[model samples]
Target: MRGRSRGSGSFPPAINTKAWFIAAILAIGFSDSRSAMSIWKSAHGGVFSMAIRANGEFFQPPVQPICAQPTMWLAALSHPIVCLVRKLELLVALLVFVMAACFFIEMSIVKPPSKEVIRGLFVPSLSGPGATGDTIALLGALVMPHNLFLHSALVLSRNTPSSVKGIKDACRFFLFESGIALFVALTINICIVSVSGIICKNSAVVYGVALLACGTSSTITGTYAGQYVMQGFLDINVKQWLRNLMTRSIAIVPSLVVAIIGGSSGAGRLIIMASMILSFELPFALIPLLKFSSSSNKMGENKNSIYIIGFSWILGFIVIGINIYFLSSKLVGWILHNSLPIYANVLICIIVVPLMLLYISAVIYLTFRKDTVKFASRGELQMILSFELPFALIPLLKFSSSSNKMGENKNSIYIIGFSWILGFIVIGINIYFLSSKLVGWILHNSLPIYANVLICIIVVPLMLLYISAVIYLTFRKDTVKFASRGELQMILSFELPFALIPLLKFSSSSNKMGENKNSIYIIGFSWILGFIVIGINIYFLSSKLVGWILHNSLPIYANVLICIIVVPLMLLYISAVIYLTFRKDTVKFASRGELQMILSFELPFALIPLLKFSSSSNKMGENKNSIYIIGFSWILGFIVIGINIYFLSSKLVGWILHNSLPIYANVLICIIVVPLMLLYISAVIYLTFRKDTVKFASRGELQVPETDKSKVANDSDNVEHKDQLV
Candidate 1:
């Protein structure tokens, strides 16, 4: 059991040896574990990355800034002096810390924030902008999981008791000490944030010095961390000088690469990026620590109590979630703004996105991997039972109501009703929280207003559409898009317009009611109004389907599955629309506001017909649909349709290029979708170019009588002349 707890004790130290261990640590830890080291060498080398981020983005320049006039101390600190400082890392770190500490002391005496401001740093703050993302990112950095590695490595130096009781006593003291340490760390972080709240004249020099201290300190500590990881992971020791030299050399690689590729201005940008990468990998390290600490086999009687386990898991997940958020937001911005060619950006995504998914998969595996469970301490058992009430009720109620084993004597309506209501209230609260977070993101984001509205148009409605019936909104990924609920329900929306257009066309015709039919002016206005409605639908649909296919975060297979299912349905929908438009008979239609009902399906039918009917002289008299109406209607329809086609085509091409699908799958997709597309074009062309065979039966009118058409035109001319005379 103890052998399983740590691999270090099981291996012979001599077998691996110190040099081999150092080599391995350079390979593994510095791959990303030494991300903290990247900042150490890169930022301490440049003195820029430790300063504040403005508007949730890291802003160190691409090149290191050079001063026009150098200070005496700076001039003395040549490349050789810097190299010496890097070598004497501990001495340099302590010296910088002392200098910074002395400066802070002087600042405290000479110029300090008001007492209220100092007091506020310790207290909760609600005054931050609605953009809580950057705040969370900052907090996540301050209390990092990797920081635990540093602490854990340091803890090995202290004497820990072997007995379970003695360890329990030690844990009590550790908890108190940890709280104090965190409080101090948090205070310092807040102080830095507050100071960074405004930019000042001396920002470069003042913050530069502060940044230098931070980077040096991190580097010094990280050197110890590398040593600790080497010994623990490989059961070997290396000389301190050799370890430090190897670590520094490896860390300098990224810095040198950035300096060469991006030039001097982008020097410290590597450190900022490395720091973000560290955040991304932070949860992977934490998941293991949590699992091991929680496992009975590893910790035995000293294993975390249920409270500690629960609390630690929650905290760990929060950190993970923050990293995911940060990664997503940053990745999106980078891809959008990058100067690289589309294919290059795409190549980057193909490589990076899978690696990210793998990272997440690794974390999830570590977190949920089953471990041996044993009896909790008496106090832990009692505490668990006491707190179980709130969490227990929902499942208990669910099982009682749902289980068929209970027969007719199962949970009554009252119990079900209460449980459902309680559940809804809880869900509603969570939805509000989620919405607020999203709204805040959109509001604070760098996107334009139209883009923001586009996001809301896409996200808000889908959420509203699904949230009502979703059993578990946040807990599961597959809620709204089920086989029946998703596939068939999606089609039903398109089918509805099948009922509507006929009812409108037939009722509005003069043959159905010669005197009752709308006047020429009223009829003209109606076409224009419908044209706008169709235009809006086209806008909404393009934003939805295209954006969903291109930008959605769903797995690739899920997207491909959706494309496969929906392409066939869309073809069917187009065929139905073409048949309906030319079909002699009509069906009764139900009409209502689309915003209040299913819309995505209706968009295709609505968009297709608006061009055909409004431009056709046979539907309305030639006088009614003037050149303006025909031109506007056709322009809007074709524009929308063209945009949709372009987007879908581009997306398909991109997907085929980047998809994990095999060649056969790609060939199959192309075969299916391409033919369906050609068929749609044929249907549309046959609909558009086909001569009309059927007439309005009830109307008993073969096309508007020539005399009536001439009379309508004359009436419109007379009305226009009267308006001009007036």
Candidate 2:
């Protein structure tokens, strides 16, 4: 990670590299010695060691190296120079901002825009030649992909709260801060655009001064961004000064070349080209942020809400769509204008088309990639502690019990007995908790007797299989190897959605909880976690499915079977999970009212079922129901149902409009989809109005059936008396 040192011994290599780079630029810029010498002397205060002849040649220095002294002097000053540059970067940025403001104000005074300018800002329009190019440049300027990576890494420098509430509060604060910053930036941009529109004449001097200040500050920011990007993505740590130097040098060479060849206009064009490159690269950065922020695995309970997820995806697609359109139009225009030979055009298309496809395919892949990083949390830490504690307890207990393993070190009789008792108690509690949850789920499901029997039969074998696997893992020779544990955990974690989705559904369901319903905090947090898990699962599943379908060498029948069977089954499974997430809660306990109020707007589907169940006499028994709650729930349910219908219709309409289909095909789709949608709405309305049929005795009144009286009584005794069913 250490950079090239500035010591006298290390000086030659560094100096030579810089010297060669400068000489190469000079060779390109000036063929004559006098002109080159004059320029060199003007820039560097006449510090050249080699003598320049009248002709365009340099006299070779002696083997003793006359240039060594000045080169060494420059090398010694390099570190301090970089330190100064780093220190000045902030001041330069402030200056740039101030100067930009001043310029905008001056321009506004010189030539003001009308009210129509405001309207134009809100409403996008392309007019005249090069409008698309101008739009591309504007997008490139506003959204630098690398800046996102820089910001992501920069935020990590702050000490973020580990708790859910703290994380949420922090997110809000950041959002506010970002909003303010963006507002200021937007104002500045608007001012610039307005001024540019009003003033037809050039103001290069004013613009250049501001641009130079901006570039100087941006170089520093870019250096830091590059460093963080490397560290975050590649996990490569390098010295900051070295990174800055290398990056600046690389950037300088290209700019110098352009300046020498294309002059100021060429340099300006270079900036535009660079901006376009960044614009194209924007999706790579944006997609990952959207994916990670919205991911449950990476963000845990801090993942984005449904609204944020939807909004971000929409914005992302809009930007991507614009870029695609711009690129395609440009490509088409270029091809048409060039009037190349048919063979050459065909060759160009062959190369470019596949590359474009690859670019699109890559974007699609990135958009769907699962966030695999498992953010550490208190619960996860507790789980790890629980598992590890048993191992430690078992070892200690065995050692204390055995006189052979530790003769003199062995505990006294009472101590050994106490240790064994504690160990047993810990183990017992773990087993009881696990068994209770499993049994609860089995008992709570509204399945038929045959289904319950089948479940038990299947579970028994699976339980045995799990026990065998654990035993094998424990006894294996390589079990203690920890090097690949991270890789192993990542592989295992993909399967976690299976466990997580079910846990969320069951825990959040009052019908399944008997008398021990989850609190509002737990339910809310669990749902967020559940959504993230489901999203990641879908991302991974879809990616793998697509990949397999594309790459598989299976027969057409096998592929068709996969498409018809596996894909549909997966879709159905997902739909069932989603439905369960929205299903009823029988009890109206804890913070149900507060949760209903908070989530009713965003998650009407989940709240609707809960409302229906809680309002039902059969479900809530004799529990008092507030008239206000009942009324609000029904109103909210209807609104939600309406919103869902609207969303579905909009999507269907959007699909129909976007695709180039015949009139009959559009008619056919509308005919088929409209009826299905109506039926769905009808079913939802029916469910909302449906009355509960099952009646349960309140409190102590036992009204059990004859066949299950003993079993019911036994189960009731184990559970709370309030949880007893009639």
Candidate 3:
């Protein structure tokens, strides 16, 4: 027999993915060593005076520049920017922290040969008010979108044999690589947190002292990572080389200038600015990935399991819900502080009334509406977008949970289940917070009769909407259709690239995503979001838009009625803008100018999908949605559409009525009759037109395509033996 060739037969072992991971971890340690050494050298003297040891370590004691007493003039001049930059650095740091947590949780499931370690990592204290919340938040943040892409691409770097032994070896190597990366990530996070916790704990540390040492440096690291990720994804190799130098220069030059001029204040300002940037930019990368991963067509059999989907949703809702809570709380607190009288508060109740209606409408849409909005554009978008400060971690839940994207190496069932439970607990906490707030608001302002009526009006519709939605989802089938992992991944791949385009064109046009890296939809959505933000900013700056219109709109308080009508619309617009712009991938937005354009584009196509999928006479066979289900879904969907149309039409009608009959603007008859009329007609039309599109086949047996051999067992022998046994 020919001697076994090393290439085909395999030597004991050659190069492995684990080595790369190990190398990366080592690289991190080396970088940390350099950082520490630099700090030490500055303590002894300047960097120029430092010398290296024979063992490749710095001999000088690293020290921060702040230790050297600066001139009063320089300190005064530099403190502002330093404060800003340090704050920005913290935001980036927090974002990265969240990403690391999510990644580790996801990785732990498919990780190799580290069962004891994995168990230790996941063990969380279950006893505190925030223990469950923090864990869920940590997990949500860690399952980052780019990290998912990074892992998928990382695995592709090595070629393995197409045999079982080869696969086993490959898995082992991949795990090691992943483990090393995770460790390094954890180290960086711990260092930052340790530094923050230590400094924050010390009252003597003060603002400038705590920031001077680590502020710009931390931001520099994050900027480097962001730039690296963006450039790497776009395949722009040369840009990375240039960006590495440019980014470091940008960070260091600013710090050096600030040190020379305003000292700590200047550096502080830069850090603060950086923090705000990161906080605001987060939602753009989060929402798209959620929509994508939860999508059945994208994940196929590997799509988010029902439990995971339900859990992640609750978590997302809670996060969004908190923001809403804060908004309401702050508003109420402000009203109380101003000492507004009881009558004014009743006027406030009038505004609150319509908002309750809109809120109910939104809840109904989310719960009962077929998950047909392949891309969310309104309240859901706002909900996801509001979570920008949390960073790309939200999408990680969607990506990591999908087995199709990760192949056989998806998160374990236990992990998915736990993640979901954690998500719900967080939502429950937020609900409690919001409910208590509403109760406080009612008690503080309105009479008992008014309060009870307010509660009934708001609570009844909201409960109905939420129950309807839950009931709908509970009954829907959970099957996804897809072919290959590559195809599945591609469906959601637009998220990363779309995230980059906005940061480029709108953020800094010079830093375009580079090449054919973005789609038309991405560009459109980014601009739309940008404009909406600008609009909101403008409104805030103008007294008439925010303060006057909101606080003093009606005469006896006609402003109150106006606020009730406008606030929800404003919120809806804001939410739509947010969803469109912040998605991981780019989506289309109809400009105020293009409102007609988008409606025309979206309406027909949207209805087409609903019509085809819901129709019983169509192609689904016995797998069709039942007649009852289809009828209910159609009624619900059409009603939702009708509401959208009615909101538009009624608002337009109200505008005409107000302008034409200015004296009658405060008339309750006008408000009640106009809105009620639109609602009645829309409801009637929706009910009449309802029909079931998806239905079971008369033949009874639904056709299914061939799937994984693991999924369905072959029973040819049993089929043949039945006759023999008979």
Candidate 4:
């Protein structure tokens, strides 16, 4: 009985044996084929030859070695392994198709399970760590940002049920369908991990070569598929083609370089970097979600349950808190080390000080920013574009839970409650994992060995406790009350509309968020709150950049370093502010020429957000922002642009000023307060001319849209008649 409970008898012999056989065959084949394939491929033309030939290209040039001779054997071995992976990938593709079909079946034929089964699914259990983690990730991934938009639109794919019972049933079916698809995906992931861990453990050379080939091939395949799919769906042509080529090149170059330089070390660094990046990226999604989901004004009576709103807030905070810690620790460490020259340090402080004040002011605005008693049309449009569109939840959660839209089926109460809890728990785990690394990095640098060890001992248990909480939430079985259509839509209405604003406002070309979005203000507040948390990181990055510059043996190199490190950063902030101030409403595309230019410049930047939002796959749905957000997000886009430009310009400017050809320095006002002067004038204009668009009210008060549509309906008819007469 004890052994059975321990899962000794839980394994079905049929599946167990099949799994082992598969693993064994994969392992055997991997070792045998590697050496032969590497030798053959290298002697011929290496992997590229095979790729080009596969594409029906005539191979011409004497095949050149793609890898060093030493690495050639390893590369050749990767070929058959590549074939195996491709075959397995095809199988996975087939599985995805099957899953899609099952989803359709659930939607069209099978009835949703009873509430009892729903309860069984939601309540946490020891079930197995593998199962538990898979379930959590499956659910997490299912809530994709794009799907929010897609699901909302897709629910309109067919006539929806209006009856409450019918709607409830449909919701149940949608949830069931999604659940099954997620489960299958989880199974595939587990299988891959299990297989790979067993097969590739000892052969570092084989592992590296195979992984690189697999990753590159998969990327290329995906790109080809994506381009082909887009071409089929849209009428984009050669000019856009060039744009795509450029964008792909820019994105791929850095990644490729990183891979080459870091090798396997790069992969680990990339993972850590990605985690921090994700943490930073979360707020961009979370704040908008929390604001939109919780708003009574946007959603009306269908607003999120207090419990949901509260839980989401806590989860968002935890994630944000962790990210802030990582950021701050790095910063503080830099400060303590004083890696930069005294002059350079002063320059940075001078630049950062005002911006810090501005950031604080912006936070005050966010905390106190009142929604207008009436909705402004332009603002509404902007808010929707900026906030609602980016997060992907507005449409997804609405349609998924809507009884009127779905009918006699919605996520059972257990599913709804458990899903939210599960999402939070997953987020919490990520936070814990990241926070531990950040803390460990800081202590290792600063603390005595014994003290650091003691700290780890204390911190480790707290982390475990956090993990336990997540586990508890996962296994807690309870029945869930399905939300009504109104409730679901309310969540959508509020979230989708409001979510757009922060992204839009912050990114806006115009400083419409006023002083709210300035880098200084934002950075300052983040720095202050995040000091103890991210001090180490800030310190580390700054120190590295500075130390590299100062310690160079060559005077020319040191000068170049200062130029690279110091000047560009300052210019980036200045440029960000300038870009924001000068931003225009390029919303309306008057011509195809106009559209192409906009897409070319904008699409690359837009890819960043899209990659982030969609990477998780399940976090968003169709509601994910369209390429249109790129046009609108030009304002916030300045942050990245400013950083790049400033980094470049500062050094160049300093160099030019310092090493002048005598003529330019005399001609230009090197010490003039031109930017400050311009800023003062602009501030005056903003203060004098800025419209008070926002109006705060008591909670539950409704805002009216700018124009009553019914009133304009007759006027539109009259205009049409007049046009006909003319």
Candidate 5:
């Protein structure tokens, strides 16, 4: 009894089985696949607003003038304002669903006749040509594949007995509970469908409320399901609100873009298209699940019986058959009827033919693939989850780059660029996650924040130092680090010119992607993203430098000296960049590595002065360093010194011993370079020990032209849309 109580055996057969989760991950956990499948759920937010507007119009009194912004409408109903847009919609959606659920529960019990209920439950009819397609959407909506992961996760919450009889009993009770849940869901769905079918135009509020509830609930639940999938498959537990925000933001952009372009009709089309995609994506999830369920080696005593397996496979085959039939018919009809250029149609055929074959082959392979993992111990799982230094980065770089392995399916240029950007995002997220964990550990030890900061002062940069080395090596020719989506700005500004500018001279060829070359729309979007990044970075960089010069307390002579150095240097680089960007012919940003080395030398030039000024009370006034920050500043100073010493020592020793340049020549090289190196070290040391010598301006002594002040304020925010570039 104690043993049974101790083991919450509900999930032991599923969650505890490594074979199950691993197989599931392979089926649906790839970044692109999961995101694609999630779009249908995301389309609802736009439709929710549409529904609100429609309902708002229906309830409007003849006396009240119409508002252009439907979202901002104040409906005549004073109490429950029909369409509460903005922040209140989510709460409104919740209320709508609750009220609808109660109404439906009572209706299902009292209104619907038993005969009609049973017939509707038991029988499905192909009433028309569109009926078959609607059925597919129905199946997709009802049998959401991601829910399998969510269910397994949820079952872990229950404390079920571990004993054989107890396990069986627990399964039966869970099954009954699930049935009850399904019945309630079905009742709600049935009533909603019926109401829509009836088309009660007089009661637009009813339908609008229904839509609001649906779009809000679908997105909310989908985001949660994604959260669980990430937790279960990848063991990634992102904060819930953050995860929701990310998902909704992703949804909003495409939806809003479509709405703006094509209006209500376009949004409706998008929703339908998303639904179709969701329907087709089901087999990818279902086949693998079916494969796992039928295997006694994986599921043990819980494996599906022969009868159940036979029935399930037949159902699976039917769904796949319907998909294939409809897809082939649609493609064939489009191919025959479309009035595009012959070459374009041929291009479409070339792309579509192989994809169709690949899809068919994949379904067959997933069905037949053997399940090798029956169990995994804790250490094995841990090792698999947290990859070591080179293992994670190296293999990805190699495999993606290897022509022999990927062949024609080689990574797209944009994909390669995006991967490099995402690598930095992953690094930033991991740093934050680990730092938070470190803080918790310090808190337990009683001296939390200061000690944590002190430890970060040592540990974080060391981690960055080595992690950066791997990143530097892994992404040599094309490295972009993203902060927001636009941080791919760096990629476009630098690496993009390398990727795209050279192509202007060459005849456009499809050899690389072959029929999968960028469409005109994609090419246009890429150009836009590229230009926005370039223009914004250029604008911001110049503004920042100007601000630094104008705002600083550096001596007038020093400021003049900086302008002398910066003006020509900026022109030289900017001219070179423009030449590279617009030139018809190009080389592969020749000696990119040497360029990196040259830029590395410039790092201390920026950091030393910035640190020296930021740490000084006179320089920054109230913004000057606190003790915690002062300690961090010293640590940075030490690190910089250590780096400089090692760099100089390594070069000096190599030049003296390794390079057998004639002895006199070697001596001459060292004599010439060593003094400049010493000067650099002397400057660093001087900055490290320097006291604040500059005086702060008196309260009213500052002088600025009124017009110039407004210009600065306006210029600062002129490119606010490009905040992501920062």
Candidate 6:
């Protein structure tokens, strides 16, 4: 046989090395020659051109081949790599199965789960004290933030047909694939939990070994997830190694710290904490996914069916509700049981409670707030992921429901009705969760008579406030519409006396309101109306107070004490009203700016007393003013007070500079005013930081009758009485 000869003086070993590397990479990525050829051609500018011929001879044309493959040995070596690459998912799945089998074998050799384990896996029960937390952890682990993104992306990666029937078939196949995978995972998890329960001592090592394998394998998946998320949201490409390195680096620091400080137990606790975090983050991922899948705009003809959308939302809300319950229970327990001093507790409550309220508000906003940025680009998906995860779902729901957007794909009436029912269920769950916690706290705490009295007083008012809030949320037309124009005018008419007296007094006094004030006729009418209103208010206050005092049975000395105190206060109040009504204006017609400046200074005087009373636990009980009401009230109060102080200081400084006051006089004024200001500030701070002292009676506690000792008995009757009281 004639042997083909190489034209070159020597075959470059570098060429062989390069060829081998190229062949190996191709083999790792593609199993079939068709795929390999396509990729190779793309890389080599149109053809899989090689420097050497099939017979180990150089081409006669002297044209430089895109790639140099000098021999067949390198190409043949890549075949096994190709096969491995093609079966990568299958290989991983097999490895997992093997590890699971090994764990099962270990369990059989040692201690194994009882038959009851199977029942436990299927039937949910929170038997023990830690069961709730354990259930939450399981939920968190089952529905992880990374896993949510991973699963969706994995499903989308399948090569499916564009036609309706083909698409349906593809979906069915994928669903089957997902169901099988999840079943396997669930089985493995159940086995692990059971095994751990059986052999609590040595199971740590065994579980750890298995977990290490699982985690190590998941690193590749995690890397891919990160890559997909980054590309989807940011439209950026990163090298696999670099992406893996970044994620590993971030995770390693925390792991190292926990390992160093807490060791293995701490590491385990860290896992629990991570699960909780994932639970909290679940809503952010879930809402968007449900929204997008249901939305006809995003999914087109292949949008999620009505039943699927309804089921998904209901499930999502259930998860969210559980997370919220877990959070609130833990927080309240911590607050109640903390070893901090009462004052410190009060301070923290004042700060942290408002923050918690804000957090809740933010969650609500995320749920309902419309998306401003339309996710039109791949990079914008990241924006949705970051800021508007919950809101991203809103558009989906909107589009899916709207005939204009979805056309034939719009949700049907049955689907809509079911969705609304699910929505109602979510709302009901939230209310029940909150109310149940409140009721439990009330029933659990054994309190003194005084505290019980306070609780009773507070509870009624709080219930009213709660009802008001619900009514406002349900029926209020617009957020900014506090009152209708007619309602406002009627309110002003009712409150006219309180405003009119001051206005008329200032206008006529000439020292406050401008010189060109109200005309005599207007002044006369204003004074008459103001004085009449004042008389009615004074009469009402006196009658109510006196009647209350007289009707109650009291000692002669006590009655005397009440009258002595009340008579003087009534006189002073009457005298003040008279003086305000008669006072004359000092200045000419004051401009609108001057009026505003005056009102700004006066606002704090009204607000401070109002807030002091409203936020007072003595007056409002444990269900005191809501955090928003209290915060907004205090903020407005402070701003007004600050303005008044600034104006007062500026005027005092100006008077001292221009009026030729002695140094001593100025110092004396400062001494008096500064102390008063300091006292005012101190009073506000004290009020703000004061803790509610009212406590409610516990489940079995009953108030004892003062008169009849024979009738009072601590028995089932007492329990019945307690129930009646609640």
Model 3 agreement with the true structure over 523-575: per-residue lDDT tens digits = 67876665665565436535555667656536845766777887786676556
Please report the candidate that would top lDDT against the real structure.
2
Top TM-score model: 2
lDDT of 5: 0.57
Indicate the worst ten consecutive residues by lDDT in candidate 5.
Answer: 1-10
User: What would the per-residue lDDT of candidate 4 be over residues 1-726, giving only the tens digit for each residue?
Assistant: 011111112224452343223222221222112222222232233334343122222123333223223222323322333444346345435535543443333223323344533465466443643343343323323332222222232333334466655555555565575577557655434333333223222322332333334233322322222232222223223232343344344434443344455543453344334323333433432444355445666545545688978897777666555445544554555666887888887787677656655544533443344543333467668644442221343245445665655676776777767766655654555665558676868556866888778877887797677556645544544345568777787555433323433344454333244334447665456435433333343454467766876786778866786778776874564455445434665554245665665564444345444444543223444554566664565445445445544544575567766774686563465455446445544553444344445444533345444475665787899996544322
**lDDT at residue 148 of model 3 (Cα atoms):** 37
lDDT of 6 by residue, 1-726 (tens): 000001011113443233223222221211111112212222222222332122222122222222222111223322334433335466558657864874676477456546677678678787977677777766666555555555666655455667887777777776787788778778777766776544333333443345433543344444555555555443457765565455544544444444446533554566666555656666655665666566665466788899998898888878878877877787788879999888987887798778767656645654665533332667657543433222333344455666655668899988877865654465455456556766787777888768867876887587557546644443444323236567777556545666777666667654454567677898889777776777777777788888988788898799899889988987887777666655554546667888898777556556766776777666666757888998998887777777777777788778877877788998898898878767766665665566657655643355555555445554567876543322
Model 3 regions lying over 4 Å from their true place: 1-238, 249-280, 323-726
With candidate 5 superimposed using the best TM-score fit, by how many Å does residue 443's alpha carbon deviate from the native? 59
TM-score of each: 0.38, 0.45, 0.25, 0.28, 0.40, 0.39
**How accurate locally is residue 639 in candidate 4, as Cα lDDT from 0 to 100?**
58
TM-score of 6: 0.39
Better of 2 and 5 by TM-score: 2
lDDT of 2 by residue, 486-599 (tens): 667766665566677667767756666645868889888887886887788678778989899989999988888889988887788688766656656455544666566445
Query: Model 4: what TM-score?
Result: 0.28
Off by over 4 Å in 4: 1-247, 260-264, 300-302, 346-726
lDDT score of model 6? 0.56
User: Which regions of candidate 1 deviate over 4 angstroms?
Assistant: 1-141, 144-146, 197-209, 256-265, 332-346, 372-726
Q: Candidate 5 on 1-726: residue-level lDDT in tens? A: 111111122134433344334333322332212232222222222323322243222222221122111211211211123422223435534644563764465344335455665676678667766666666666655556655444454555556666776566666676675676556556666775454333333343344444444544444345545666555444557765566555544555554455556554555556555555666766766775566667666556876789978998999999888878878887888899999999999999999989988878867766776555556667868644543534476568657865556667888888877876776666566666666776677667766678778987998797777567666667655333225436655545645545554453232324434455677777667667666765675676689789999999999999999999988876775686577666653333335566676666666777778877787776677888787987897787678667767877798887689875898998898899889888977877776677767788855668888998999888778765223121
TM-score, cand. 3? 0.25
Query: What is the overall TM-score of model 2 with all chains considered together?
Result: 0.45
Question: Between prediction 4 and prediction 5, which has the larger lDDT?
Answer: 5
Model 6, position 593: C-alpha lDDT score: 89
> What TM-score does candidate 1 get on C-alpha atoms?
0.38
